[model samples]
Structure formats: C-alpha cells, structure tokens
Target: MPSPNALRRGRRLSSALALGITAIVATTPAATAGSDGRFGWPLQPRPAVLRHFDKPAQNWLPGHRGVDLAGAEGQTVLAAGDGIVVFAGTVADKPVVSIEHPGGLRTTYEPVRAEIPVGRRVGRGTRIGTLESGHPGCATACLHWGARVEGDRRRNREYLDPLGLLRLTPLRLKPVRP
Candidate 1:
C-alpha cells in the first residue's frame, strides 16, 4: 500500500491533471481557429438584423452581447463557420446552441432547439438547430446570435461583432462626373 503522504500527493496530482485537461478542452477551438478570416452570417440569405451587438460596459452589466435577427419560428439556424459544437442546451428556460470556430471564436444561437451535439464538428451553413418561441430579447420569432473569442479566464473572454466576420461586400459609390 502507498504511504499516507504518497496518497495525498497522488490526489493532488490527479486534481491538477483534471484541471489541465478541462482547460485544454475548453480553449482548444481558439487555438485551432487561427486567423483565417473565414466566416459568414449564421442566417442564410442573411436575415434582417433586428438589433445589433451592443457590448456591455462590464461583463455583468446590462448589454446585448449578440444580434437579434428576424427569423420565423422553427426556421433552421445555420453554423456561421466550421467548428465543433461546444454547447447545446437550455439556459434560463431558453434553448441555446454554441459552436466553436477554428479561430477561437464561438458563435451562439438562442431560442433554438439544437440538432447537433457537443464536440460534433460542423461546417459553415450546417444546420445546427431550429428557432424556438421564447427569446425574451425578441418580441416576435427571432434568433439571438452572439459571438465571442474564447478565453482561459472568464473575464478574458471578449465579445465581438458578428458582422465583422461576415464576407458581405460593402456597397460602393460610383464615380460621377456628368
């Protein structure tokens, strides 16, 4: 049998290992995504943005971290980019799905019934889930989509504007000299 001191040391070592593994799993996508700049709108044909991302002054303060897009109830929600499903479940009575893109960015859809499972790899435009009925943020049927860069620490996680990642070409004015 191992000595008492040895047992204590073993337990500590095990705890450390567990923590390390958990951290790696949680932050793996960020490292995998790199800076490819390949992302698109989560909603196909790009639904109208009912509301834009308004970052909160502080993490816990009042702010809309994601955009609320106009969508029909039961409409399919697509993955914004290729990545693995990190989370799929309900929170505060609202169903939510989160996908982790290769560049460490995680996109989220809420008021959704997830079709994918955690750890499942998905591609851009993949059907992740369907829109549900109860998003308090929206008066009518809409999908609340949010994005954030994965961080090892809670405070370090940074929320980003999903529009910035989209590949939509901006409308430019034509030169006129009549």
Candidate 2:
C-alpha cells in the first residue's frame, strides 16, 4: 500500500534506530557479567545479606545506602575489586575502608579495621581489613558495603547497589531456535 520511495525511507529509519540501540548496548556496562568477574563479594563464603541497598528518591533523602552482610567478628573483609585504598580510617567512630577502582567506582566497607593503609594498591579479594561487631540494627556482626560513582560534586555522586558489581551467577548459553 506504500510507495517505493516511502518503503525505502521506512527501511532506512529502522536501520538507523537499530544501529543506535546497538551502540547503546555495546557501551553500557553489563550489570551481571562484571567484566568477567573482576569484582566479588567483600565477605568470604558470601555471607547472608541482612539488608539490601535502597536508594533514596533524592540524594538528601533517608535510605539504606548500602547492603549489610552478616559476618563474624574478626572476620577478614576482602576488597571487592582491584583498586587503591583511598581512605582507611574511622567514619563516625566506626572503622571503615574505602577503595577507588577503575572507572571512578568507589566501594566502602564499614565496621572494618583496616590492615592496609591509604594509597596501597590492592587486587580483587585482597584482605583489606577485619570486620568488627556492633553495626546498628544488625543482631550479629555485619559488614555494611556501599558503592558509588565519583562525581565532581557531592550531590552528583550516584549510589549503586554493591551486589550488582559481582558476577555470582554462572553465564549460560541458550540455543537459538530457527
């Protein structure tokens, strides 16, 4: 029902749209792949998740900024990814260790006594500190893990669910049906 010229134009538009979608998918980070497991859980044995990361509607709004993993007191807390120790000190009287990874991603672990000092380069799964008890609202000792993208301004920083950084599920290949 359409003219030849209109048919060609529609095909061109569809091709351009497909190309644009492909470009976006190629550039966007794979939430589950984690770049072939570059990142991992901070707590060994994949401790139970007491609480999950809950982002606030606004940066200033109240929300759970990180996930709490049940860990035993004195348990070693490993680095989630390869990065340099940016901060290894107490935050609000609670010991914390923060690492700055590639691509401006920063991960923070609380209730951890830092074994590595600031500016030290650490690989994935490196023991950065030991977990301590007394995390608020947790019945047992837990490690609060948080992640964010470093931005120019404080409000510009975007908080992320730290769990998405790990490639826990194995990749599967599905057959394409003709």
Candidate 3:
C-alpha cells in the first residue's frame, strides 16, 4: 500500500491537473479571438472609413477610454457586436446603454438619444442608440461609444477605446464641426 505522503502527493497532482484543464477550457474560445476568430467590428459600416476626430472628451490619462465618433446629433448608433442590453436608461447623469457580447466586450453609449429598453438583445451593427445633441457651447454632437471590458462598469480604467477594438488604423484628426 502507498504511504500517507505518497497518497497526498497523488491527490495534489490530481487537483493541479483539474485546475489546468479548467483554465484551458475557459480560455480556448477567447484565444480564438472571437466566434469568427476576428477582433474588431464584424461589419464594414459606412465603407469602413478611417477618419479620426478631435481629442476625446475624456481619456484614461495614458490611454483613451473610448472612441469619439464624429456623428450628427441623433445619428443612429449600432451595437459593435451581438449582445444583450444589460442597461438602458438615464444613469451616470446621461442616457447610456450597456451591451454584453459573447466575447466579453461591453459598450456604454454616452448621451444616447434613441429608445431601447433594458434586457434587449442587440446584433452587430444593429441600431441600438443615437447620439444626443451636443452641448450649447460645444461644437458638434458626437457619440462617446466607450467600451467597458467584461461587463465591469465600476472601473474607469476598465474602459477601452472602441476604435481600438474596431481595429481601424488611426487617421488624422478631423476638425470638430460647429
């Protein structure tokens, strides 16, 4: 019969193996990048134009948290990918919608003007929101489509630039319309 120490070692090895397998299973899908195995916008909206805009209204200091898309007030906004609308309503002092994707991506549209109830599921490039009218003193109305990773909205730094995730090459900043 195996000694006590020998049996304990066997148990430890078994536990470790189980943990390793679990980790592998969890990451396999993500490691593929996405369902279609591609990261960024799944569709070419507006012909995939690569036009940049003025500096964002907010950023993560060393990094930008969201991508400021130059849009007219009330211009239709689309869901970056297929996901369920986890939140919809005026919160955080502005109208916003949060969508959770299968690949763990989430988006919060700042100052949305469109109507969409919470618990609604949205598809890639589906119109889920619209940009609100810009501030009186401000130049133009733009969409602050921010990405909060993994449905964790509490962390400000947890946000990512929607442009980066969309995989567009950075272009020259366009002047903000008045």
Candidate 4:
C-alpha cells in the first residue's frame, strides 16, 4: 500500500496526464478546420461570442447545444463550411437552416430568414440567410449556431463545441506551486 501523500500525488499525475491528452486531441488534424477538416465563422470578423456550448449530462436533459453570436437583426449569416442545404424552413415557428457538410456533420442556424432554398450547395462564408428578430431565450437578436455529428445508432447524437472547429491554440495547463 502507498502512503496517502503518495496516493494523492499519483492521482494528480493521472489527472494531469488526462488533461494533456485531451489538449493533444483538441489540436490534432481531426480536431480543427483545415484543408480537409475545419469550419469558419458564420459571421465575418467573428462577432462576439455571446454564449458558449454547454452540453447536457443526458440526451434528454436541457442544455445549450450551440453558441450564440452577437449580431444585429437582419445581419447576413454565412455558411461555416461547404455543405448542402438539407433543411431551410420554420421549426416551432422559428426560421431555421441546416447544412450537411462532409464527415456527416450538420451545422444549424436558427432565427434566420433563409435566403437559399434546400438542396443548394454553399461554400464556406456563403450567405445563407439573415438574422431574425426573435432568438428564443436571447435578450437581443443573435445567431444560434449548432453542429451535430451523425453516425452510429448505438449512442445518442453528440453535440460538439463549435469553437473546437476553429483551430484555436491549445489550452495550456499551468503548474501550481506552494
């Protein structure tokens, strides 16, 4: 058996290792937008990120599945990547547009007035629609951007952080000193 201090040290080392692995995965080629895999901001100059992705603990649980970008009503919304318009209509009375990209990924923009019809192939940064007035829980007009990975039926569909596709700098873990 190990001493309590030793055990604690071991656990800390394990945690640090796990976090390091996560960072590595996040920065890998499969993780970000690039020549083969990646995405762009729906809003040029990248508007302020009003909200971030907050995945729920369960599939049926309530959580913010996407990011909210600060934008004025009627601001043009662009496609994050090259994809086909799979859906462009009203859902629950809110105008929504969904584009299916490569790798079975689907990006969605809500409260947008659709400018293009379904089956349209849009390139990255292509104008897809305009921001609308109502944004569910948002206090002001904002574009809600969401992405979903499509595959395997065994598990529920997973919602990914849109920021992950931005190819951002790796998160650094700082050391603690006494």
Quote the positional error of residue 3 for candidate 3 in Å. 26
Local distance difference test, per candidate? Answer: 0.81, 0.87, 0.59, 0.83
In terms of lDDT, which candidate is strongest? 2
By how many angstroms RMSD does model 1 differ from the true structure? 5.4
Q: Give me candidate 3's TM-score against the actual structure.
A: 0.58
Best by TM-score: 2
Estimated TM-score for each candidate: 0.75, 0.77, 0.58, 0.73
Off by over 4 Å in 3: 1-64, 135-138, 151-157, 169-178
- Tens-place lDDT per residue, model 4, 71-161, is 8898999999888999999999999999987656678999899999999999998999999978977788999999876544626466877
Local error of candidate 4 at 71, Å?
0.3
Candidate 4: how large is its RMSD? Answer: 14.3
In model 4, what is the error at residue 154, expressed in angstroms? 9.3
Rank by lDDT (best first) = 2, 4, 1, 3
lDDT of 2 by residue, 44-133 (tens): 898889999999999899999999999999999999999999999988999999999866678999999999999999999999999999
Those runs of model 4 whose alpha carbons end farther than 4 Å from true positions after fitting are 1-37, 152-155, 169-178
Candidate 4 clashes: the total is 2
